[model samples]
Target: MDEIITRLQRIENLLEHLQAERVSKEFYSIAEVAQMVGRSEYTVREWCRHERVRGQKSRVGCGGTTEWRISHAELLRIQNEGPLPIAKRFG
Candidate 1:
């Protein structure tokens, strides 16, 4: 019983460490965020443009290129609360 308890504690510690390392990035691309939220890329893009969720947009190109990046913290927010109370997009 004691050995089983020690093994369970080790497993718990490993799980916690893995969870922390899972979100290593400060920001995530629209596609990545979509995968995390199980939503379409188009939907995530709209969320960024519509301020449903906070994101940083980049459009530095002659061809009018645009890309959105969401911070890990913002994604966590979205996970905790549905996208609402429109936030101002930045960058």
Candidate 2:
């Protein structure tokens, strides 16, 4: 009986820990998105580069270089329905 109570307590603690990792930011970097999606940073960058995920380049890097940022809404959309369609070019 004591062992069962201990196991349940441990599971509850683990669940709380996992729940604490919720997304609380409006925008996230490529690295953050990569970890959330279980993919590499390179792959996330590609998704932004190809317009496959509705990402935007923000001026938030060193040396005045821009970096890709994904919104929380887009991340949810991706987790629910995969990538967005490729945007049409106007050239």
Candidate 3:
């Protein structure tokens, strides 16, 4: 029973490490965000153009396309806000 408990603890530690690594490595591209929120990439670009979505800019894609790296926190905010008032449609 003690050996089983020790193994379970080790597994728990491994799971925690994996979760941390996943969070650190996780990054969403513009297209990914658009798909996630059911918007168009063009709309997302427009929002970025108008400073709608607040996030840090990051380079993405093989050709180094510029993308706004919206963190999970910002996404939650946007979700709660229920879309930008003026902007009709999102990408």
lDDT at position 57, candidate 3: 83
Residue pairs in candidate 2 whose N, alpha carbon or C atoms collide under 3 angstroms: none
lDDT of 2: 0.87
Candidate 2 Cα errors over 4 Å, as ranges? 1-23, 86-91
What C-alpha lDDT values do all the predictions have? 0.87, 0.87, 0.71
Ranking by lDDT: 1, 2, 3
lDDT accuracy of residue 63 in candidate 1: 88
Candidate 3 residue spans exceeding 4 A from truth: 24-28, 55-72, 87-91
lDDT of 2 by residue, 46-89 (tens): 87888888999888757888999999999988778887666686
Would you list the clashing residue pairs of candidate 3? 39-91, 40-91
**lDDT of each residue in 1-91, candidate 1, tens digit only:** 9999999999999999999987669888999999989999999998888888899987756988878989989999988896766554442
Residue pairs of candidate 1 with colliding backbone atoms: none
After TM-score superposition, the amount by which residue 72's alpha carbon in candidate 3 deviates from its true location, in angstroms, is 4.7
Q: Is candidate 2 or candidate 3 better by TM-score?
A: 2
Q: TM-score of the candidate numbered 1?
A: 0.64
Q: What TM-score number comes out for model 3?
A: 0.54
